[model samples]
Target: MRFLPILLSAAILAAPASAALKDEAGITEGLIVVGIAYEISRVCPDIDARRLRGLSYLLSLKSAARQMGYSPAEIEAFIDDKAEKRKLEAVARDRLAGMGAVRGDVAGHCAVGRTEVARDTNIGRLLAPR
Candidate 1:
């Protein structure tokens, strides 16, 4: 009976350390942030994707996730998951839309991109002036 309390306490303390990769905000949100930068650069006339930095950031995320116990297959599946992709894309689209992006208006996207760039945000870190 005495050992039971200690066991429960140990499990409680250990639970958070073994948390899943998907729950890690840095890597997961980094994907969305980087994706936003890439999309903005794609449509924004004055913006360009920082190709090497983007690639390196992604690689670092993969490495960090793996270090946190995520398997390569698991990471790939998360990255490729259609549902997750749609969800993240929707979020990105909403963010851009909120910043004045319109379907056919490159200028709007450019403005948003330039603003993000000027702010030096996570999204802007993946983009550069064209």
Candidate 2:
């Protein structure tokens, strides 16, 4: 019975801090682009790079928007915004190229079989569309 009060107090204290962090750390369009670019640069081979980059960007944006408390409608609206998408795509492209230059054969090192890459990095799971 005594432990119950302590637990409740702890929960109360933790809740506001978590809420504050969520509010402050809302996902940005730039972040979604860079995240997708980074993930694709790490895992995808050059042969499949363009397709994987597009898919990864959409997945990352959806996941990040949901995490930041955006509603489905809002997410759809954001997706529909062509200007935003174009900007993000340009940023993603640049970041991907930069990563390629710096990493020097990222795909050669990291692009194992899909099953192996999935098992090793868990990136397949993270970037999968929900």
Candidate 3:
């Protein structure tokens, strides 16, 4: 909740001027991944410790790619590379498993809340590639 707002604000403020040059859908997916990661980190830290860390790494890669002025096509090519895709998929799988194992309604709460925050802020769309 508190963290979500802060994260969204930071993401918006820290975006590079060339952010618009990256793929919109790709960025959106990355943002969603980051949100889910954050939620898992906070709500189910004991589930899969590496899941959040891995997602943070992926977000960094995207941020770096944008800062380096990579076009949307180039960014997508890098992210979609077999090796990179595998890493992403692995992290996603781990996160999903964690969500399933979490106790009580924490997982549901985190998912719904984070998703609403992401959608309301439109952080991904704001950085849509040109």
Index of the highest-lDDT prediction:
1
Q: Rank candidates by lDDT, best first.
A: 1, 3, 2
Q: Between candidates 1 and 3, which one is better according to TM-score?
A: 1
**Which residue pairs clash in candidate 1?**
none
Clashing pairs for predicted structure model 3, backbone only = none
lDDT of 1 by residue, 1-130 (tens): 0111221122112212222565778876876776677777778778988877877777788788889887766776666555555666676677777879865578987888888889998877778987
Candidate 3 similarity to native, TM-score: 0.35
Task: Residues 9-62, candidate 2: write the lDDT tens digits.
Answer: 221122111222222233444344334434453444542323344445445555
Query: What's the number of clashes in each of the models?
Result: 0, 0, 0
Q: How accurate is candidate 1 locally (lDDT)?
A: 0.67
Top TM-score hit? 1
TM-scores of all predicted structures: 0.77, 0.37, 0.35
- Model 3 residue 62 CA deviation (Å) reads 2.5
1 against 2, candidate with superior lDDT: 1
Worst 10 residues of 1 by lDDT: 1-10
Instruction: Give a tens-digit lDDT track for model 3, residues 31-119.
Output: 44654544444554333223434445455756766676766456555443444445444554455445452334565634543443456
lDDT of each: 0.67, 0.40, 0.45
